[model samples]
Target: MSPSHHGTEPVFDVTGVTKVYTSGEVEVRALAGIDLQLFAGEIAVLLGPSGSGKSTLLNIIGGLDRATSGSVLFNGRDLTDFSDRQLTRFRRDHIGFVFQFYNLIPSLTAWENVSLVTEVARDPMTPDEALAMVNLTDRMSHFPAQLSGGEQQRVAIARAIAKRPEVLLCDEPTGALDSKTGVIVLEALTRINTEFGTTTAIITHNAGIQQIAHRVFQFLDGRIASMHVNEARIAATEVEW
Candidate 1:
């Protein structure tokens, strides 16, 4: 069946996608026929061990990488058909990414770092609004170095969501922080997903983190080993790491 006929059409429709890389004489299959769908206004977590294709899938969905075979559709448009320039525009206009390292500029204040993307975005929220959403409004004037690790990550999240992108992709967003700090960051992420209604996907190795997701997919050997719906997702603050 075509993806459009699904009960709720997915924001991301990945079908039988595969990615292979060759290092000298050795070839690695990073993704082995991944078929998944991520719907709107939901938090989906991809859980897996290293090299299990979690990041690979995220990259493909974000249009940062291409698959060797099969197709990925975003809002029903085939991503495989987009040219490089088109892909760039698509990513810039429709997707937001948050990484584990909290890649904020040390020289810039929190507001400034968040505003950088707004300056170039076609339509964006004010830096104040974005910072407020992440609970960093009071620290808007603080530089990355001046903020705590969790705060820095919050600033990164602010920067990403400032553009009001349709999709938010997080790659182990709390990986660099301690468990307590990570929960704070996750709380901020959860707030964003709930308030903004952005379709969100997070990649993580932390099984405990999955409790905060509306749905979870476990990756094994570069394929989806299991998928389960979470009827009652605990708040990030309530979940133990």
Candidate 2:
């Protein structure tokens, strides 16, 4: 779906956020003073190279990691002040994550793997329902090894979204796949964002993928270097480098 203009508060409102990792004689800053917002029903793409901190910012926003300083507000609540337990609960209740690698359990079938998370979610859709979103209903009974790379990634996407989370954070969701397979994965993601209205943030090295986002943020040296709205957005099926 196109970005909504119903005038809701931002899902994520971050300001001057920072993250630093100390290693003896050296200190590495993963994020340096970032200010950004992910509005409801918006698709944002984080475009940058290996050390640009795009993933670091995504992790913080998704509650997978904490910022070293500044504010991280989720719908007006200060996430920076949340306790570890609170952060855990927040992630469980509000966020879904998809990574580049298909982290599906080798022993479990697609349905079983997705079921594992839905069972614990507060208001989850059925495993079959989730699988259908990623167009994997026909292959739900297949084990991870039985599927193609794209199919496995689709299963992973199903597992992430089955919980009906308000936001979906994806870190290089197509990174490990070839362009043809990557297009299918991106299509799945675009479908999820449209059908569920899940505020989405994707981190990718492929600048071509920016065409699918409502807004594109370019990161460099641990900071956002540039950002722009894509007025002429295109479908993922039409994306090409």
Which candidate wins on lDDT?
2
Candidate 1, 161-234: lDDT as tens digits: 99999999999998999999999999998898888888899999999999989889999988999998887789
TM-scores, one per candidate: 0.96, 0.97
lDDT of each: 0.92, 0.93
TM-score, model 2 to reference: 0.97
Q: Where is model 1 more than 4 Å wrong at Cα?
A: 1-6
Worst 10 residues of 2 by lDDT: 1-10
Off by over 4 Å in 2: 1-6
- State in Å the error of residue 181, model 1: 0.7
Error of 2 at 90 (Å): 0.6
Candidate 2 on 55-130: residue-level lDDT in tens? 9999999998999998999989999899999999999999999998888999999999999999999999999999
